[model samples]
Target: MATFLHRLGRGAFRRRRLTLLLWAVVLGIAGAAAAGSGSGSGDSNVTLPGIEAQKAYDVLDEKFPAANADGASARVVVRAPDGKKLADSGPRAEVRSLLADLKDSSPRVAAVADPFVARTISADGTTGYAQVTYKAKATDLTDADHNRLDDALDDARGHGLTVEASGSALAPAAEAASSEAIGFLLAALILVVTFGSFIAAGLPLLTAVVGVGLTMGAITALTAALDLNSSTSALATMLGIAVGIDYALFIVSRYRSERAAGHEASEAAARANGTAGSAVVFAGLTVVIALVGLAVVNLPILTAMGLAGAGAVVVAVLVAITLVPALLGFAPERVLGRASRKKSGQESRPKTTASKLPAAERWAAFVLRRPWQVLLFSVLGLGVIALPATKLELGLPDDSSKPTSTTERKAYDMLAESFGPGFNGPLMLVVSGGDPAATKTAVAQLDRGVKDLTDVAAVTPATYNPAGDTAMVTVVPKSSPSSEQTKDLVHSIRDRAQGVETATGAQALVSGTTAMNIDVAAKFSAAIVPYLALVVGLAFLVLILVFRSILVPLKAALGFLLSVLASLGVVVAVFQWGWFQDLFGLQTTGPVMSLMPILMVGIVFGLAMDYQVFLVTRIREAYVHGADSRTAITEGFRHSGKVVMAAALIMTGVFGGFIGGADAMIKSLGLGLAAAVIFDAFVVRMTIVPAVLALLGQRAWSLPGWIDRRLPHVDIEGEKLGAIPAPSEPGHRDADFTPTH
Candidate 1:
């Protein structure tokens, strides 16, 4: 691997233009492809086991009528340049025009909100919106449904309306993705600023582009077999941008530094492969492992994210090591603007360290001087800033209370205000068995308990299936879906439901928005053990292999655990405690998104591992050269501190950028992820890691020499870096050059 990579790097230096053109073509195609995906129609792949999804679906079928009613979604708000927004009147003209046109066009338009009539337009003249009240028969609410709605909105926007839509799955997604694309590019610019070179800047984004393209393509393919959610699109984009850019940056910086130290391009690429490349491989894998942790929850959305993101990270790391080196080999002599380093050196030059490797002088000086004090203040600061997180509620208003300011939100608000919170009602428990009589008894048993539930407005007629042991029972809450009363009503049903496992063969599970969440939370709570255990176990093994020490893995795992717990604690205090609710602009009763903490840990763990890889790669390299663990730890922090911090800040900006978007889910996602990266990068990686390592000393890399010798050896170190293979490799180095200056 090293020999091949080394040869490839050397050739890259000789043929810069060809390499540039190849990547340009690749990017042009990717961009064109992405633009073509404007509506995100092609991305979907559900990884949840079929049985699980079947169970959820069966529950859906047993509950609400097997009809086509989509619970109401958020409404759209369109404003003109002067704040003159049209609602009922706006959608009226368009709807009527659309209807009149559909007379000549298609039937789908007439069925949608009756484009010419009531559901298509608001009563007011300032806003244009359509209300699609899914009659109790909406069996499918996929992205395509959302896309159709967006197309309708787009038709309106095309005629010179400034549009803001907040409803349907695609509505949030369109807002999320369009904004995210801009953010990824903004982050790319920030990355360029940090690297201070176009090629340097472009390389990470290039890797990111490749990663996203392939991930998007693969995800698009997955939709055929899996039930991948629309949210997965935004997820892939976010992860692709964040990991792709960071992963490439780590390697490129190392490669350029190696080239300058009098090593041939092949040798430099090899060394980069040996050090930064290896770290990247582990970091990327760790991300994959962390993502797989989401599988524990058994939710389709998370399961899909885990699989897709796992694939994305893999692509990112491979490209960082492969394509990046290929580009660097043919890059101009002065890659970092050193006119002479470009033209100098051969394979036999002295082994130079990765440039980001911390030097002993300044690092030891700083750590020894203020080690404990820095630790004290930073940890304290993290604790204080996290104090406000106590008010974070996990629940959002059900589909009934649209979380935006549009007509849908108003409709939801009106419903809640008029109908009490449980207008949606209790969860439907589906049973597929032989006991027609027993199913009847089980449902009756369930309805009686539900009637006994506190704060119930009423239980609707228990429509039962004698043949399938199926029953659809509705239990309306005494309060709105947004109220604590309704949540308690849901809790009562799950705890004391219509189906008793020990007594009856019938299975009764909750399927309403409220009930589904309670089940999701309970299920998520149960998975906590194995999720952490697997993450720790696998990450430990990877860390051990990479650093060649048991102690380092333990320390890495421990520090990461602390950071996650601290973050979770903040989540609990803010959302659970209901403190500072107004300050943060959150609901007092909303709990953290059930899937968020686990996802955060996985994502943050991966990111933490990334910084760990960057910081420790060269430090490990220093150690193999005989530096003591303390020196290595201190030096490692200094060496990669700047780069890791820069990446973290940029990612922080990228994740936080979405807060300005339309959906609260996106805002929460942005803020939560941003917080995790910022804390891990600046606090844990920079200060806490070194302190803990200094305290632990040599234990970090302790492996018996005999076992180490016997273990299967993987090479991270490369031999030649500046040249391509001798006519054997498929790709030739490009002649186009990027000024390293």
Candidate 2:
């Protein structure tokens, strides 16, 4: 495997330019083709299977034969110019004209509902609404469709009228479009800075662009294959830009370092391929493992996330080797050349004083220069940033009223004004009982409790099949599903109804939107720790065997934990505190997504491993070559610091790009990740890690001599797992021990 990797790397070094151009071209063509194909994407149906939902869909189909067939079940509510005029005559006229236009021009609109003319209203008929419903030819409404609907409504409004648009289709589409562009730009900048040379800088971008392009092409072509999830574009945007760029960065950095060490470009490429390139494979694998795990959720949207996320990672890893190497091969040593001119007859010059200086000389000087001040300041700085996390609230919300436009905003207002403040769906709690009388009595009591609560606006009489073990209660709150009130009701209902059915020996389980989120948090308690232990322990075990170090693994894990904690703190402050809207330009009020933290940890941890390997591997190499602990640590930092910082900056920028986008979910993700990277790079990698390692001194790599001798070295990544030695009485030490301060 090592030999094969080396040969492949060398081949890329030999043929870099042609390879890069080909990948770029392939990526571009595929991207353009996909954009063209995805034009009607927002028009698809959600494909949910339920009688009421289906009935609702059928009603829409029956009413608005003018709507899109292949599109989503789209709806538009026409009010008045002031965003408050909700009456039938004004709304009905507008709905008729809109339906007329739909039927005449693009006849795909499956159905449109005239709720204004037909609805049963209050005794005073002054307040009325016209609802126009249409199905997307595809699945959900894209940003383009939303814009069109908004424009049409704007054009149609002649007098005192208001229009509001709502539904699943419109919101996500608009959110995706804005974010995708910002993410792309940020990722590109990061890639360029990491590889100073244009050729090298372009390698990752090239690979990403191509991989994403092809995947998009496949997504477009496969729209015919099955129902592609509505989040396809956003998914490709994330994976293609993030994992794609990341994979290339790892391989490119390795290749350049190898070439600088004096091997022929091809040979340097080969070694890098065997090492960093192989690591990329593992990194991508872990992400795929975690993302694919999302398949257990049973919701198609999550299934979409799994498919797209895993697919993108796979493509990124593959192209990082095949396409990236080919691109790098074009210029060989020049592909990742340092940012300096080759003077008249000089060799490529070093750009920075740090690069020119010997690693040993620099490490010794820094510690001697700043040991006391550095120790005092670094901890204090990280401590301040971590403060806000203490106030975090992990409860999920039920507000699905994301602002799509003036129409959506108005629609949200109308719903609140006319109907009441609450989500589309409320807490669906089920309490089981024995007989019809008992069940009725239990439901009556529960209804009274639900209605009396300050949070609940209304409670429907229980939907009970008395002979069965379940009685369903739908409790409507006075706020959106994501509001604090809804969360409060979730707690109240669960606590109040836990043992409501003693006669049936049955219990009540609250299982609506609010309950799902609360349960998710509960699940995280048991799940996150074990998952962390598994992955973190796995990473440590691998590092231990690879480097023959006990203290090193402990130190790495320690640093990883501190940085991760800090990231968590930021997540709590921004998401739990609802600070994203004011600070980061995200207008969101959703809870921390149930799966986000676990998935984030997996991705962040894997990426952190990249820096750990690159920086630490260099330090170990210096030690193997006979530098003392302080000297090796300094030298390693000096040598690998630039690439690490560059990588972090680029990644951070990419994550930060989503701060101003429309989607709260995307912004939250980007902000959390970006903050984590910045924290990891500056505080953890540069300061905290160095200090800990310095403090540990020679003990960082210590392992018992007996254990080292008895256990044949196991390298899970180096293809060295075949090495086996008989177990002996386990006692071995790899280095002389020194206790940490």
Candidate 3:
């Protein structure tokens, strides 16, 4: 691995112009393809096939075409001004006119139902709602369509009525831009501090941005042929930029270290690519493996997300190994800090005594001195933070979870206040069977049974299709959509469905936005254990290959799990339990987003293992080169500690920037990922790992003889590079070299 990478890096450096041109060409091709293909829509359907909600949806799609299963819908909630009633002649005329105008608002407007005709007026006649249906899905709606809808809404508000629009078709309130800009700025600052040169600092940022553009362009281009989710682009951007910067940071930092150690520009670039680049590749592969493992859950949206994110990481790895070395070939001496440049091109020796060692080495020495206490306290602290995870409840976010400033949220509040929280989440009961009469009887029975059930707010009479082969009934729960009681009610109705079927000889299934979201949450929940097992198992194998040891991989995986759970606990505390909501700019809190746990596990696991591989690989490298375990720990920290800290801080800053987003899911994701990086990078990898390994001594690197014999060697530490004599050394050969190991 080291020998090949050395040659590759040297080739790229010597032919720097060619390498840079290749990357530019790739980016240009991707951008052109995306431009020609244009933008695409996302697939928000996450319902599992076997679930009741999905089954109900299938029935509706087959038997009742009028349900408009694929179309978008909206509710325009209108309230009369103070001292006014919607039923009054004057207000009623305005409301009727508003509904009439909605029909001609846009060509995409499929249908509009009046409040009076649909009997949607509030019992007090103070508030009413009109239903607007669009011919296309929400993602397919154009800016013109939105403008027309807005014009219609504005006209209604022009009267004395208080009008707000909610639902899927309202073109979800414009989201605040993601944390990319903030991430870039923070990464630039951190890189500048780490490298102490504006030019050098910009290399990582430059490579990262290029990698992101390439990945995003490819995603956009492919969207023309695929049903990729819109969120996939955002996620890919986040991971691509982050790993791109960090990967480049590793190689650049190592190159400078080599330059400071008296290696010439070309040799330093090759050596950096051979050693740090190997770690970057392994780190990147771990992330890719963890993300692509999302396919195990068998959901298309998640699969696309994982694949897209993994593709970004792969691009980052390629850019780091090639572009970075090529760029370094330009002016390697300029990358050196002023103090490093003053050393006049001589090899530097390591400081022997603790007092003379760098701060990282001194910290390692201090931890080794009291390994037991450090391990105990670090483990206990993480365990305490993980306690909140026990009470975690999962649900998808709704308008109620949006910021109060959004019209959707205001509309939701108005409807919930006037009608009841249940009005926000009506469950649709679909009854169908061989006999039309039997299906009608089943629908009637369901309505009566559901009404008698506790927590039932109201059950609408059954509406039958023209064939009378299918019937639909709407049941409203007393609780909000995300509430535990609503989920329980959904389950209760499904349980009672069997009796209704047995009596009337018809099939009854439950579905609606609320029930469908519940099913989605349940599906994600069930996938957690399997997804975790897959990521951890694959990561464990990858680590074994990288480190050639069992205990180290075990320790790395366990530490990652600890950090991930602790991060999730914090997410639940903040997003679900409503603790310190104001601190995160949250207007309200309920159940945490259903997929956040699995998402956190996949993403955080990859990043955690990344830190683990980078940190531990250095220790193993020192040990393999004949340093004692204790000395190796100190040496590894002395060489790699500062870079690791800088990488983690950049990753944290990038992720933390998302917490400021208006979207609840994005905010939760940002916070969860940021917190995980902090815990794993600072606490687990840095503190607990060192303490635990210090106690284990040489045994920490032990592997069974049989396993070692069968395992394929992966020289991730670039140990073979030792055979390649430095330019300053005697008997050095420029052309041909053989790897010793």
Candidate 4:
């Protein structure tokens, strides 16, 4: 593998101009294709195929077309500006006129319900809502269509009325453009400080952009043939930037080190590619494996996202191993700067001794001196942070979670204030099969039963289908949609409806946005354990195969688990418990997003393994060269620790930038990922790993002889590079030579 990579790297360096031209061509082609393909809008549907709630929703749509016609409708909410009652004749007339104008002006408007007559007016009579059904889902609407709707809503703002809109269509775009820009800027700053060269700092960012662009283009093309959620692109980009910059940074750092060691540019680049590039390949594969493991959950949305993320990482790896080396070859002199050039001229003789990072070496030695104490302290700290994870609740954020500046949040607040929090997410009860008369009776019975239950705000009269095979009912809870009480209410209604089924001889199925969210939460919660197990188990096995050490893999797995838990616990405390809601501008406390656990587990695990591979491979390499385990650990930390720390900070900055955005989910994701990177890099990789290795001694690298023989060798550290004799060395090392620690 090293030989192949060496040849590839040398060839790339030799053909540097051609390589640059090829990448330029690929970027242009991909950018054009992506622009032409139109990546399409996102899907907010969280329904799992074949689930009971999904089946119920399908039956409702099929049976009661008119009743469900506005399933995707947007609500235009108007409040009397002076706190005047909308029930007054003048204000009511103005509201009615506004609705009429909206209906007449927008071609996309399929129908607009009368606010007063439809009982859409709030109890206070100061606020009213009109339902506007569109020809298609809001996300599917064209730009012109959205502009028309926006204009129509704007017209209603006068006449002493405050108007806001909320629906699937009215959802604020993810608005990741600003966040991405900020992330890039911060990444550049970190790289510049680390490399002390403007040109060197920009290379990783450039490579990341190109690789991410190519992957996004492919994803856009795939969307034409398959269904992908809108969040997939944002998630993919997030992962892509992180891994891309880190991968390139590793190789570039190594190249600079080699050059500093007095190797020629071409030799340095090839050697860097052959060594750090191999670790990049292995780490990239681990990330891909963890992401692809999302398929085990059997949800198309998650599966698509996983594939997209994996694809981006693949591109990152490829760019790091090929394009980065080629680029480095063109300007190796600039990479190390003028100071390095002066030093090189003064010391023309080849460097015989490898330079070590003093700070990292001192830190490692300090930890090793008190191994048990360091390990215990680190474990206890992680444990405290992880405590909140046990009480973690999972639910998708509703429009209520949006920033107050967004139209969705305005509408959500208005509705909750005047009508009730439950008005934002009403449950749909579908009674199918049996006699049409019996279905009606069953619906009536279920409605009556649920109306008297706790949290019941209102139960709309049953509306039966024309075919008499299905009936529908709407149940509104007193609590907000994202509240725990609402989730419990949904369960209670379903349980109560079962009794109605026995009494009326009709099948009762509960579904709606709220119920769908409930089902989604349940599905993801059930899948989390298996998903974590699968990703962890797979990562453990991969580490074992690469490092050929049982204890190393076990230690890595435990550290990953701790890192993930601590990150999640912080999210729960902030987002779920509302410990500092005002700090983050969160308006309400609720469960963390349903998919956060699985997503975090997959991503953080891969990242944890990435550092594991980079750090451990160096230690293993030193050990393979006859260094004692303690010396190997110290030398490895000295070599790779600074690079690991730099990469972690950059990744944390990239993820943290998203918190400045309006989306609650993105904010949670940013916080969780940032926390994970910080804890893993500083605490786990730095303190716990070294301490554990020190205590384990030679046993840390022990692998059964028979299993080691059977396992296929994977040289992630490019050990073959060590076989090449240095220009100053007469031959390979003497068998009796042993360096003092």
Candidate 5:
């Protein structure tokens, strides 16, 4: 592998212009393709094929087509400002005129129901709502369609009534692009400070942009055939930028170090590519494998998100090895800028032994002196953070979770104020495939049973379809859609409706936004164990191959688990338990989004492996050269600690920027990832790992001879850079370092 990388690096240097030109061409093509194939925000529906709830949902749609059409329904709310009754002649006439105008506005407008005929006026007579159904789903609606609705509502706002339109079809404000821009700016600042070179800092950002651009294009094109959610591209961009910068930063920093050590430009670039670049490849694989392991859950949205993120990582890795090296070859010395040159000159002069060891190395020595204390402290701290994970709840965020500034949120609030909180998400009961009379009687009985249940606000009479086999009942809950009481109400209704099914021989199925969310949460919860096992187990096997040590892989797996749990616990506390909710601008508290756990597990685990591979590989390389475990630990920390800290900080900032987005889900995801990176890099990688290795001593690197011999040789630590000389040889540095094996 080292030989192949060396050849590739040397070739890239020899053909630097050609390599740059090739990447330029690829970038142009990707940009054009992405522009031509505009992006899509995925459908809001969470479909789980083969699940009982899904089957019930499908049956309800089939039997009661009017209630579950392909289109979306919006509510146009009207309020009287002067305390005038909305049922009065002036306000009522204006609302009627608006509804009539909206119904005739566009071909996309399927129908608009009258507030008077539908009895949608509030009991206080100061507020009322009109229903507007479109011909397409919310995600499928065109901009022009939304514009027409906006125009009609604008014209309808007069005559003592204020009109506001809100519905699923009206898209929420997208803050992802702005958030990414902020993240990039912050990353650039961090990079410049870390590298002390504008050119060096710019290169990683450029590589990340190119990789993300190409991957987003491919993801956009993929939407033509696959059902990708709207947030998938944003997520892909986030992961892509982070890994791209980190990967290139690693190689570039190594190249500078080699150059500073007096190696020629080409030799320095080649060696860096052969060493840190190799680690980058292994790290990229860990991330991709963990991401792709989302397929184990068999959920389409998650699968799409995982694959999209994995694709970005793959591109980032490729660019790191190919484009980054070629760019470095173009201007090897100048890439590090003036500050680096001054530092290199200072290093060239003779130095004392104390100055040779950096602060990180000294800290390593300090930790080793009290390994047991550091280990116990880190474990206890992580355990405390992980406590809240035991009470973690999972569910999809509803419309009410949107920012208050959004029209959807405003509409939700207005409806809840007027009609009750349950108005936002009402449950539908479908009784199908039975005698018309029998179904009606069964529906009536079920309605009576549900209306009497706790947490139920109202139950409407059964409304049968034109076909005698189908009937529907709408149940409204007193609590909010995302509340535990609402979810319990849904389950209770489904369970009790079975009695009516037995008597009337008509199947009763619960189908609505609340029920669908319940099903999604349940499905994700059931799949969590398998998803974790698959990702962790696969990561374990890969690490074993790379590190060639059983204990190393075991330790890495356990550390990753701890980091993920701790991160999740933080999310549960902030987003679910409502601790410091005001700080994050959260209007309400609910369960953590159902998909957060698995998604965080995959991303955090991969990232944990990323640091582990970079840090441990250095230690292993030193150990293989006959340094004792203790010396290797200190040496490895000296070599990689600063870089790891910079990388982790940059990643944390990038992820933290997403918390400013309008969506609560995105905020939770950002917080969790950022928290995980900080803990893994600082606490786990720096403290626990070194402490564990110190205790393990020589056993840390042990592997069965037969298993080691059979395993594929992986050289991530650049052992093949040159042979190690004997410790007794003249000018040998190994003897200067104390051995504690």
Candidate 6:
């Protein structure tokens, strides 16, 4: 591997122009393909095959087309001023006018039902909502369509009526682009400080942008074929930008270090690519494996997200190894500042004793000074932070979780206040598999059984399809959608469904927005154990190959688990328990997103392994090169800690920017990922890992002879680089390079 990378790196250096041109061509092709493909249709709705909720949902979409068309809907909620009733002549006239304008003003508005006609008016007559169905999804809605609705809403407000809109047709505009920009700005700033040169700092950012752009373009082009959800690209973008910059940073930093060591530009680039680039590839593949492992969950959206993210990591690795060296070739010694630039044999290099070591190395020495104390403290502290994970609850985001200022939240509050909390999340009971008459009979019986349940708010009469082969009964629960009581109500209805099915020889299935969410949560929860096993287990084997030690990989996996658990605990505390909710701009607290844990596990596990591989590979390299275990730890920290810390901070900053986003799911995801980077990079990788490795000493790098013989040798330590002589070496013609102790 090292030999191949060494040759490739040197070739790229000599052929820098061609390498750059090839990347440019790749970028241009990807962009053109993405642009020509046009916008794709993506559904955010969850679809789980074989689940009862999915079966019921599919049946409805197939059999009850009118009720389940491929269009979005909105609830135009209206409320009169205090002491006034919408039913009164003046307010009623305004309400009717608003509804008429919504129906007539925009071609996008397929239909709008009158509140009074649909019986959506509250009993008190102060609040009512007209149901408006649009011909297209929110993403498909044009600006004119939005303007038409906004005009009507403004008119209603002018008439002394409080008006708001909610539902799929009125989906909030995404602010992720702004958040991403913020992340880029912050990343650039961090890079400038780390690299200490404008040209050097911009290189990683450029590579990151190119890599992420290519990944996104590919995702856009593949969206329709893969049936990717609208939000899938967000995950891919976040991971790509972060890892892209990070991978480039690692290689660039290594190249500069080699330049400082008095190697000429070509050899430096080659050696850097052979060494740091090797670790970059190994680290990147672990991330890829963990991300692609999302397939174990059997969720299409998650699978797409994982695959897309993995694609980004792959691009990052390739760019780091190929593009970085090529770009460095363009700059040469200019990549190093005057103080850092070294010519062969210009000066004798001082021995790197403890006192002369950098702060990063000193920190490593301090941690190793009392390995047991550092290990115990880190574990205990992380254990304390992980306590909140025990109380983790999962659910999909609902209107109540939106900001109070959002129209969705306002509509939700008004609806819950006027109609009942249950109105927001009514459960649907689908009865089929019998004669029309028998189906109707079964539906009625099921409705009666459901109404008798403790939390049942109301059960609508059976509504049959045109053929009457299937019937649906809407069962509104007494509690809110995210409440435990509502979940219990769903379970109770499904439980009673068994009896109804047996008695009438019919199939009774429970489904609805609420029920589907419940099922999605359950599915995500059930997949966690297996997903962890697959990701952790696979990553463990890869780490063993990289470090060539059983205990090292085991330690890496365990540390990753700790960081992930601790991050999840923090997410739960802030997003669910509402701890410092205001600080994060959360308006409400509920169950953590159903997909958060598994999503976090995959993402954080991959990222955790990133730090693990980069940090441990360095330690292993030093050990392999004849440094004692303790010296190796310090040497590894001295060479790699600044770059690793910089990478972690960049990732943390990028992810942290997303915490301020409007989307609750994105916010939670950002916090979870950012927290994981902090815990894993700073705490686990920096502190606990060195401590444990110090304790293990020579055993840390041990590989069983039998196993070692069978395993394919991965030359991550760049042993092959020895053939390429350095000027500093005794046999080299220059012979000016000084060796540090």
For residues 1-741, write the lDDT of model 6, one tens digit per residue.
Answer: 887887788778777889999999999999988888757557777778867888997888877777678787889999988999988898999998998988975788889999898888888989999989988776687767777788888888998999998877764565745878888999999988888787788999999999999998888888767768866888888999999999999988988878777678788888999988899988999899988999888888888888889999999999999999888887876677555554445552457676887778889989988999999999999999999999999888888888888888899999999989999999988888658877876877886777789888888878889988888888888898888899988888888889878888888899988998889888888889988888888889898888889999999888988998999999989988999998988878988988778988988888888888888888888888899999999889988898899999999999998897776777899999999999999999999999999999999888999999989988999876888776456775531222211
The digit string of per-residue lDDT tens for model 5 on 1-741 reads 665676577567667788989988987887777677645565656677766567767876777667668687788888876768877777777877888888876687888888878898888878788888888777767777778777778787645567776777665565645778877998899889888888888888988888988888788776656767876887898899899989988888888887887766666777788888889999999999999999888888888889999999999999988888888876776787787777775664355486576777877887899999999999999999999999988877776776676667677788899999888889888787557888878877887788789898888877787887887788889998888899888889888878888888888888777887888888888898988888888888899899889998999988888889899999999988889889866777778888888998899988999999888888887898889999999878877877888899889988988887776677899999999999998999988999999999999889999999899987777777665233344663321222111
Assess the local accuracy of residue 43 in candidate 6 as a C-alpha lDDT between 0 and 100: 70
Give the Cα lDDT of each candidate.
Answer: 0.62, 0.60, 0.87, 0.82, 0.82, 0.86
Off by over 4 Å in 1: 1-178, 185-189, 338-364, 376-397, 400-404, 424-426, 429-449, 464-469, 482-488, 494-509, 569-589, 715-741
TM-score of 3: 0.96
Q: List the residue pairs that clash in candidate 3.
A: none
Off by over 4 Å in 4: 65-72, 81-84, 171-177, 345-357, 434-438, 502-505, 582-588, 723-741
lDDT per residue (tens digit) for residues 559-634 in model 1? 6765665666655654456455455455432566666767777887888888887787766766766788777765
Q: After superposition, how far is residue 425 of candidate 4 from its true place, in Å?
A: 2.3
In candidate 4, which residue pairs clash?
42-230
lDDT (Cα, tens digit) per residue for candidate 3, span 1-741: 777888889988878889999999999999999899855566665656677788898888889978736788888999998888998988898898888878888788888988888989888889999999988888788888888888888998898788999877776556566579999999999999888888689999999989999999999988758878777887898899889999999899989888877777789899999989999988998999899998877767778888999999999999999999998877676777666677646557544575777777788888999999999999999999999999988777788888788889899999999999989999999999787889878887788789888889999888888899898999989998877798899999998899998887899988998998888878888889988888889889989889998999999988998998899899989988888989888888888887677877899989998899889988998999999998889889988998899999999999988888766777899999999999999999989999989989999999999999999887888878878988668986453323111
Ranking the candidates on lDDT from highest down gives 3, 6, 4, 5, 1, 2
What's the CA RMSD for each of the models? 7.9, 9.3, 3.0, 4.9, 5.4, 3.1
**Per-residue lDDT for 394-419 in model 4, tens only?**
87778766667778879888888888
**Residue pairs with clashing backbones, model 6:** 345-736
Alpha-carbon RMSD, candidate 5: 5.4
The all-Cα superposition gives candidate 3 an RMSD in Å to the true structure of 3.0
Best candidate per lDDT, number?
3
Model 2 accuracy (lDDT, Cα): 0.60
TM-score of 1: 0.75
lDDT of 3: 0.87
